[model samples]
Target: MIIKVPGSLSIGQVAESTGLSVHALRFYEQEGLFVNAVRRGPGGRRLYTQDDVDWLNVCIILRASGMPLTVLRRYAELVREGAGNAQERLALMREHQERVTAEIGRLTESLDLISFKVGVYEDLVDQGDAAVRQCHGPSLPDEARTPDLRHEAMAE
Candidate 1:
C-alpha cells in the first residue's frame, strides 16, 4: 500500500534496523517516544527516515541504561522542539551520567571485594592448610572440606 524511497524505511524495515519489534515500534510511536513522529507514505503506511533510526538507537541505549520511560519521553519532546534548549538536554544527560558514574564506582568496589575473597580462598588451596581455611571462612573438621569441589575429584 506504500511506495518507499531509497532513504525511507517501512515500519518493518525500521524495526529490523532498530532491533525493536513491530509492536514495540508501534508502542513507542503511541508513547511519543521518538524525537520526530514517524512519517507516513502514500497509503498511510509508516515510513521512517535514517534520522528516525538513529534516534531510536539512542533511545534504545538510554532505555538499556535504565532511564525511565517518562524521562525518555521528555528528552524526546525537548529534542523535537528543536534547538535553543541544548542546556536543558545537557543537564538531563549530566544527571544520568553522574548516577551511572556512581553506580560504576559501587560495582567496582564490590568487584574488588569479591576478588579479595577469591584471593583468600585461593590462599587456602595453595597452602593446603586447614587451619587457615577455618580462620578465613570455614571450620576444619575431619570430614569438613573446602568449598572447591575439584579438590575431592582430584583426590579421587
Candidate 2:
C-alpha cells in the first residue's frame, strides 16, 4: 500500500521538475521503471513524492546514458525485491559501465575522423583554395586533384 506522504506533487509538477513530458512519465510508470507503486489522491489522480521525483531523475540520467528500458526495468525489479541482491546489481552496473566505456571509445574515434576533415577544410580556407577545391573536374590543377571529395555523404 502506498502511504500518504506529506508534500505530494501532482503529475504536472513532477513533469515540470523532471523535464519529462506527462506522457513519458506515464509511459515510465507503465514500463515498471518505478521502484514503488505510484500513489493516488482522492478521485484517483496520480500523486508523487520527492522520493519519486528523485528516482525519476536517476531514471532520466540512466536513459540519457543509453540504458535500455528492459535493463532499467530489471534493475527496478531487483530494487523492489529488496535486500540480498547486491551482487546482481553490481553485475548489472558493471556490464553497463563496460558498454558505456566501449561507446565512448567508438565516439572518440569518430571525433578524430571529423577533426581531421575539419583540419583539411581549415587549411583550404586559410590558403584561399576553398573555391578551387569546391569543383571537382579533370581541368583542375594537379594539387587540386587530390581526390573526389564529391561523395554524397560529404554534401552535408
Candidate 3:
C-alpha cells in the first residue's frame, strides 16, 4: 500500500498507505485542511496523488501531537498560499512545538508519579504493613478545571 503511487490513487489506497480511515480523509477535506484539493474522477470518486498522501501523513502526525483541527486548517491554508506565508507558518508551528514540549513534561511527571504509586502498591501488597505513599499533584491548573478559559490562557 505504501508505494510511490503514480497518477491518481483511490481513497482506499491513500487511507491504507497513510493509516487513516476513508472517513477521516473525507473529514479532513471537509475541514479544509488539505493543501491540495482532492480531485474527483468518474462517479465523483475522490482521487489523491502521492504528494497528497504525504501531506495527510504530516497532518496525522500533527493531529497525534494534539494540534486542533482549527489550527491545522490554518496551517494548511498558510501552506496553500505558497512561499510568502512562511513566517506565519513558522510562528504557528513554533507555538505548537512549545505546547507539545510542555505536554511532554507534564506527561513525564504524571508517569513518574504513577510508577511511584505502583511501587507503593507492590510493597504494601507483599508485606501487609507498608507506609502508604501519597502522590499529590498540583490542583488541576486553572485551565483544566475551567472549560471557557481557552481564550484567556494558553489553552493547549
Candidate 4:
C-alpha cells in the first residue's frame, strides 16, 4: 500500500523549502538517508511531498548534530520495516538522545567558558587594560579553549 502525501513537490521545490541544495538532496537519497523511497514522475524525475521535505529537514538536523549515517540508516530501515521494531527504534533513539545530551553538556560548558571570557574582556575594555589592546597576548585561542562539539558527539 502506498501512502500519498498532501502536496507533490519537485526537487527544486523540496530544496527551496528545506533549505538544502538540490545536490545535497540527491546526495542524501544516494546515501540511504530517506525513510521512504521518493516517487518518480514521468521521465524518471524525482518527486517529493511536504512530508518528504519535512522528514529531510529532520535528517538534516540529525546529520548536522553529528548522528552517524550508519545509525540513521538503521533507524530508517527499522521505520520502513514497520511496527514490530518500535521498541528497538525507541531504544536507538534513546541512545542517540543520550549522546545528544552529552553533546549539549559539552556545548554548555564551552558557552560558559566563552561567556566568562567575554565578561573578562568587557571588564578589561572598560578599565582600559593596555595588555588587552595588544594583538598578541598570553590568552588562549578560542578554538583551543573550547571542545569541538561535533567530534565530542561522534566520540560517544
Candidate 5:
C-alpha cells in the first residue's frame, strides 16, 4: 500500500524525478547526504519535498563532476548549518573549481594527442595497403623513431 502525502513525493516518485534508484536514494539518506532529514509518511515510508528534489539535483551534479562523497557530505553539512558558513562554503567550492579546471586542461591535452593519432591513421588509410602494411611492422627502435620537434620549438 502506498501512502499519498499531499505536496510530498514518495521514494519511488523521487527516484523517477532524480533518475536515481530507490536503493541509491536510501543509501544517500543513510549517508546523510540530504541537507535536511527526509520526512516520513504513513507506515514510516520516506516523504520528499520539491526542495529535497532540488537539493538532490545539486548533489547529483556535484557527484557526477567527481566530488568525493566525503567532500559532498561536507558541503551538505555546511549548507545544513545555514548562513554562518558562507566563507567556508566558498573556499570549498573554489578548491573544487580549481581541481575541475585542472582536470579539464589535462583532458584537453590528452584529446589533442588522440586527435593526432587519428590523423596519423587517416593518413595511413589514404596512403593505401602498402602504407598500412608498413605502418603495422615491428615497432621502431627509440633512436629510429622521429623525435617530436614540436617540443623543441616550444622550448625556444
Candidate 6:
C-alpha cells in the first residue's frame, strides 16, 4: 500500500497502513510511545506524517518483541530529548537486543523439539504403529522432563 510521503495523512490512513486500529494508534500517542507529535487539523482531528508511520513501524517491532511500554516510553523520551544521550540509548537498545536474542533462542529450541515430535508422529503413522498413534504423547524420557531449557524459558 503506497504511503504518501509529502503530505500529512489522516488517522484512518495511518490505521489502515499500519494495520493498527485507530484506537490503538491513539493509545500509543497517549502512552507517549510515539516519537512525533501528531498535528491537528481545523477541527482538531489528528493528522499523521510519514515520519509517524516510520516510527510506528519501529514501535510495532519493539512491542511485538515483548519490550515493556515503560522501556518504550524511555526510548521515546531519549529521542525527544535529542543528542548527548547516545550512550544511554545504545545501552537500552543493547539490553532489549539481549532479551530478544534470549527469547529467539528459547523459541528456536522449542521449535526443534516440536519438529522432532512431528517427525516421530509421521514415522509412526507411516509404520502403522497403533500404540504410538493411540498414545500421541511426548517421547521424552521421564528424567528429561524437568529443568530443561524449554520448561525454564516458558516458565519465565
Tens-digit lDDT track of model 4 for 1-156: 123346788898887777789999998899887888999999999999777877887787788788899998888788779889989999998999999999887777667655655776787788785645422222445555444543432342
Give the clash total for candidate 6. 0
User: What is the overall TM-score of model 2 with all chains considered together?
Assistant: 0.79
Q: Which residue pairs collide in model 6, if any?
A: none
lDDT of each: 0.76, 0.79, 0.80, 0.75, 0.78, 0.81
Question: Best-fitting candidate, measured by TM-score?
Answer: 6
Cα lDDT tens digits, model 2, 1-156, are: 122335899999888888899999999999999999999999999999988988898888888889999999999999999999999999999999998998887566556546666766786888885344542222334453223333422554
Q: What C-alpha RMSD separates each model from the true structure?
A: 10.0, 8.3, 6.9, 7.8, 8.1, 4.8
Q: Write the per-residue lDDT of candidate 6 for residues 83-142, one digit (tens) a residue.
A: 999999999999999999988876765676677668766888788846443322345554
Candidate 2: deviation at residue 25, Å? Answer: 0.7
Give a tens-digit lDDT track for model 3, residues 127-152: 67655644433344654533433232
Candidate 1: 10-residue stretch with minimal lDDT? 133-142
- lDDT-best of 5 and 6: 6
Clashing pairs in 5: none
Global lDDT of model 3:
0.80
TM-score of each candidate? 0.70, 0.79, 0.77, 0.76, 0.78, 0.82
Mind giving the per-residue lDDT tens digits that candidate 5 earns over 29-127?
A: 999899989999789999998888888999998988889999999999999999999999999999999989987875665565556557667887898
State how far residue 23 of model 5 sits from its true place (Å). Answer: 1.1
Instruction: Pick out the ten consecutive residues of candidate 6 with the lowest summed lDDT.
Output: 131-140
Q: What would the C-alpha RMSD of candidate 1 be, to one decimal place?
A: 10.0
User: Candidates ranked by lDDT, best first?
Assistant: 6, 3, 2, 5, 1, 4
Greater TM-score among 3 and 6 belongs to 6
